[model samples]
Target: MPGVVWIALAIVVTIALVLGLGASRLRTLSRRVGSFSCNARASGQDAWTAGIAQYAVGRIEWWRCWSLSPRPARTWYREQLELVGREPFDDDGPGHYLVRCRYEGLDFELDLAAGDYFGLASWLEAAPPGRRDLVL
Candidate 1:
């Protein structure tokens, strides 16, 4: 029927518009620190999955590349993060290096290009000096 066709077209257009708006809002809210491509393995999982990480304030927001949601899949706070080790790229892969880190009792591996590697390392290491409290 004509009415059914019109309703289907309207639904498709609405879905496209909503996805476009969500992507635009995500881009506007997050600042791109550097190029990132990575795989994450949860504590119990034996396999790795694709993810992307972006730095925001004092946290690293990790998002699943296949997801359309604007929210971060995982957020690693700076205060509870620790760098464990790094592995250099073995071949001509897209990732230049892989940095492993532990945050909030979970471990995550982040892959970065040469340029991004330095930025990520510096961001993690640039903690301010400790402040002492004065006795009243």
Candidate 2:
């Protein structure tokens, strides 16, 4: 029916607008660090969810890649974060390595590509002098 068609069109338009706005917001607010993908599990949560991390002025903002939300799901401040450990990814996926980090006494895992790994390492190392202390 004509009403059904109109409703479908409206739904499609709404979805498109949400996606466009989300992408625009992400690009305007943050810069791409590299081809980075991560699955993070909060300290108390047992499940891990996939997301992407963007470098902000003094912190890293992580957003769920599948969601259209404009706000970051988690923000890890540079000064309060420490690298715990790292290991090569076991699966043959795009991610090359897995990094474990502690922020504000909570642990988080980030999976990065080779380039993203270097970029993250550089970002941490380039923090203002005495801002971060390397654990290893």
Candidate 3:
């Protein structure tokens, strides 16, 4: 009985440590420049995931909030994204919109606030000259 109790306590402690590390990593990522709260879903996915997005010179990096790794889970290059659709998303709020886009032949959706949506649009349009034309 005592042995079982000790094992359970150890498991609980390990889980807590992992959670703490993940949260710490998320905080560190959120403090970077151009970071914004964003929700993303892949095409055919039924659920959206919350994460932080940071804009780099020519790409956007998305990092899941509950992950322990520092690397971005997905990277969307500015030149490769094609806007498919944009509509007001009232599920979260009035100013939020669901932006659908295609990258590398795969479609995905991003739920973004008005300000963030505009920022993303501007980023897409500012791609370097001579790249494939992006139909917005």
Which one is best on lDDT?
3
135 in model 1: Cα distance from truth in Å? 33
lDDT of 1 at 74: 86
Model 2 clashing residue pairs (backbone): none
TM-score of each: 0.67, 0.71, 0.89
> Sorted by lDDT, highest first, which candidate order results?
3, 2, 1
lDDT for position 133 in model 3: 69
Pairs in clash, predicted candidate 3 = none
Error of 2 at 65 (Å): 1.2
Candidate 1 structure quality by residue, lDDT tens digits, 32-110:
6542665676544556666677778877788776567778788877777777777786443765776677777777666
For model 3, residues 1-136, the per-residue Cα lDDT tens digits are 9999999999999999998898888888889889998899997898999999999878899998877776899999887888889999998979999999999999999999999999888778777787646746
- Give one digit per residue, the lDDT tens place, for model 2 in 43-131: 45656687778778988788886676768888878888787887887553764777788988878777677777778878888899886
Number of colliding residue pairs in each model: 0, 0, 0
Instruction: Check candidate 1 and list the clashing pairs.
Output: none
What overall lDDT, based on C-alpha atoms, would model 2 receive against the true structure?
0.74
Q: At residue 14, what lDDT does model 1 achieve?
A: 97
Query: Cα deviation in Å at residue 120, candidate 3?
Result: 0.6
User: Model 2 segments beyond 4 Å from truth?
Assistant: 1-5, 19-36, 43-48, 92-95
